[model samples]
Target: MFSLPIIALLVAGAQAAVLTLQSPRFTVSSSTGSQLRSEPISLAHASSIPVTLTKDDVLKLTFQVIDKESGKGVQPHQTFLRFYDQNSGEEGIQPIRVTNGGKAKFELNMARPPLSLPPTSDAPLQVSLLIGSSTYSPLALSLFDLIVPASHPVPAHPDEASFHPLPEIHHTFRPEQKLPPRPISALACIAVLAPWIVLLGLWGQVAPRAVHLFSPGIFPFILTLGAFESLLVWYWVDLKLGQVLSYGGVLALVTIFTGKQALSKIGDRRVGRK
Candidate 1:
């Protein structure tokens, strides 16, 4: 009787050992959007996937993980869902937690904030999925992006072709227009020194100074020269270097103009610096 009990204990221990050796390895199955995987999934296989979506549409994904040997389900602590754009290389990811016997599901809404939809339709949007690994398995999806074109909502048909609405007729220039030949830097330089040059040129004619202010066309000459010079400076400072040179230019111009006014007044005794 004692021997029989020992044999029963040995059999139980062996069964427990088998179960311990049989824990699951993860596999991925996906039903994403309208696309479905048609072949056995493997690390080496390449998958061609497609999705269909309309602007402001929402989508859901259902997938599973399973044990390779016993056909039991498996779930991971953390899994990531990703959206990829094939053309522009844009992508987004959301984390999903698996529960209730290794089943995972994800829902994503398709909407654009700075919406670009149509009138236009069938724009290509490709997608790819990444699970836990850095490399995505051979599964991906694609879609067509539809955006409202600029021509949409045709401006309220003018009361008459010649009614000529002022608002419509007026051109809206891009804020980036005139772009300073570079940007704010060049524009700032022109703003700062321009007044000084103009005032100095005018003062040269009226003051008790020997400096030729405008004779020989120096005023216009210098003005034109500075304009071009500053353009190059603007490009160099703002465009090439990506630094704004205008702030320093403004401060220096203020100092120079004020100082000149003070000095001129002291020299000519005119209004204590004119």
Candidate 2:
């Protein structure tokens, strides 16, 4: 007796050998009337034709399947159509099953309206199709070139009285609309340096003995101020909060090191005095 797995494999092989895909045919229609009734064309030898269509136009594609040995129509259980636009990189998939006649049909609506083109220019709307299935291999069809026609000019009214000149509009910049100067101000520079100067004075006056031992002088204060001002300038010019915070962290580390050195010098002096 055959095992269940063996039986399943045999059934799948039989199904694969029997099912065969045929060439697809299509028809195009617009608001005016039917445009084309294409003959069955093989997927390999399929050619693209430049087709001009309006937003109201519709295209219907028909895919047929048949038995390879018997040459009879075979209804597919399920079918999937993938339509892709090459230029826009847009894609859409539609699921449609075959009918009794082994024909699966789907309609494509042209929603993108046509634009005006120069006399020597042609804008190609490139599109392609793919038919996929779980049992059979995917079928890739040839590209389709679609063209949208420019809009027609509206006719002027026959009555001269109905026509009037449009109102005149002025396009001029006013004084109030002018942009403010972007240069950094002197007041801002003073504000950033003022705090450092005040701290240095306090350290000298309030702790005169300690200042003599741990006198870092103006060099450290100037270096730290310069670094902080550079960060401030970068923040103002680039307006990057992340860079400001990163540079600020580095400045914090520098300040901490300077403070520790001053404290150590003062501690050493106290021990010496003791």
Best by TM-score: 2
> Where is model 1 more than 4 Å wrong at Cα?
1-49, 111-125, 133-274
In lDDT terms, which candidate is top? 2
Residues 117-167 of candidate 1: C-alpha lDDT, one tens digit per residue: 212223344333443322212223222222211223325565656566455
TM-score of each: 0.29, 0.38
Q: Give the per-residue lDDT digits (tens) of candidate 2, residues 1-274.
A: 5569888877776676455556676667876676754555455654566655666787667767766677677665556554444544444455666877766776666554212221111355444455444655445556456565433433457774347776688988666865445455666777889999989988988865533532564346456767888889978988589878878998979867766665676677779962
Candidate lDDT (C-alpha), each:
0.45, 0.61
Candidate 1: residue pairs that collide? 116-147, 116-148, 117-147, 117-148, 118-147, 118-148, 123-145, 265-273
Compared with the true structure, the alpha-carbon lDDT of candidate 2 equals: 0.61
Distance from true position, residue 138, model 2, in Å? 3.9
TM-score, cand. 2 vs. native? 0.38
Give candidates' CA RMSD values in order: 25.0, 23.1
| Pairs clashing within candidate 2 | none
